[model samples]
Target: MDSLNIEPTEFTPRINFDPENNLFEISGFSRPENVIGFFRPILKWLDEYSDSVLSRNIDFNKSLLTVNLRMTYFNSASSKFILDILLEFMKYHSRGNEILINWYYEEGDDEIQESGEEISDMLGYPFDFIPY
Candidate 1:
């Protein structure tokens, strides 16, 4: 599957999805005026990628999928969308895919760390929280 790269804007985060390298990253701030519009394509891409992987009979056990989330800030609406994205990854992982989620937060930022913990707890996924 082709990669999906979206440049970061003042109100949106940068999205980089590279299947070849098995790296998926979303960083920066997210407060898009149209939250749903901003995330629809991303969700679609994940669905397509999941389909592709399933159809190709790929061995996810041998390859790991790494997802990095380094958000400095995000609005409430964006938070919901962010969870949706993570849930997609959770689905992929539930299907016996080897996946790791790395949640990065700035040092001294308790809010971000708590947010990651909350999401991790909700999804029942053990995420690696890296404080920079």
Candidate 2:
């Protein structure tokens, strides 16, 4: 029942780390002054969680990791930090663990859809885009 749930604030993104269910979610805007400082802990959490899960889940016959993202927009500076997060998750995917990332965007957002495509191309991470 390990979880790290952080509420959304004016300067930070919301984080819901539910390892027991293998359901992690990150949403809200991210234009913080120090993006590195904000996301560093989340990245660290993921790393440690990876180690713990690998040790306990020998067969991995349980739930899989599902990252649900619904970011409206992000600043140019935050892009790199977010990129790191995606890459970390991709590692789990590469290891044969089921990884599902859902990218939700508002309707009629061609730019966002195209950006999603760019991300899929850049990271080679398969994402299911859902229009809202």
Candidate 3:
């Protein structure tokens, strides 16, 4: 599958999904005017990625996939999409792929950190919560 890269905008985060490197990252603000329009392609890319992994039956333990999410602020709508993105990754984890999700939040931002915690709990996945 091809890599998906999107530059960050004033109201949206940057996206860098490099399949060759097995790395995915999203960071910055997210309050898009059209949330679905902004995220639908990303979700589609994830679907294709999942399909590729499932088809190849590749072992992921050797090269763990890493998903980094660092957001300063996001609207309620964005939160739902973020959860959806994480849910896609949850699929890989469920299939025994070695995956790592690093949820970064500002040192004093309890809300963001808690949000990550809640998502992790909801998905039953472990995320490394880092404070910056």
Candidate 4:
């Protein structure tokens, strides 16, 4: 499958989704004017990836999906979409997929860490909190 790479902008984040390498990352700030429009393609890509995985009979056990989130700030609307994205991974995990989420935050950034914790808790998935 082709990878999805969206450049970061003043009001958006950088997205890098590589299925071949099992690496998915979203970094930078997210405060787009149209939240849904900014994230719709990502959600669609995830859905397609899920379908392809199933249709291709990929081995869930051996496929390790790594998700890295390095967001410094985001608006309330973006938060909802971020949660939705994580929930999608949760569903993939529930289906016996090996997944690891790394939430990266700057040093001494309590808010970001807290947000990550909250999201991880909501998704019922364990995430490694990495302070950089």
Best by TM-score: 4
Candidate with maximal lDDT = 4
lDDT of 2 by residue, 25-91 (tens): 8887778888888888889988888888844667846457898888777776777777788898888
Tell me the TM-score of model 2.
0.90
Between candidates 3 and 4, the lDDT winner: 4
lDDT (Cα atoms) of all candidates against the true structure: 0.90, 0.80, 0.89, 0.91
- Runs off by more than 4 Å, candidate 4: 58-60
Clashing pairs in 1: none
Q: Per-candidate TM vs. native?
A: 0.94, 0.90, 0.92, 0.95
lDDT of 3 by residue, 77-130 (tens): 999999999888777767777789999999999999999998899888889999
Tell me the spans in candidate 3 whose CA falls farther than 4 Å from its real position.
Answer: 59-63
Clashes of 1: 0
Q: Clash number for every model?
A: 0, 0, 0, 0
The TM-score of predicted model 4 comes to: 0.95
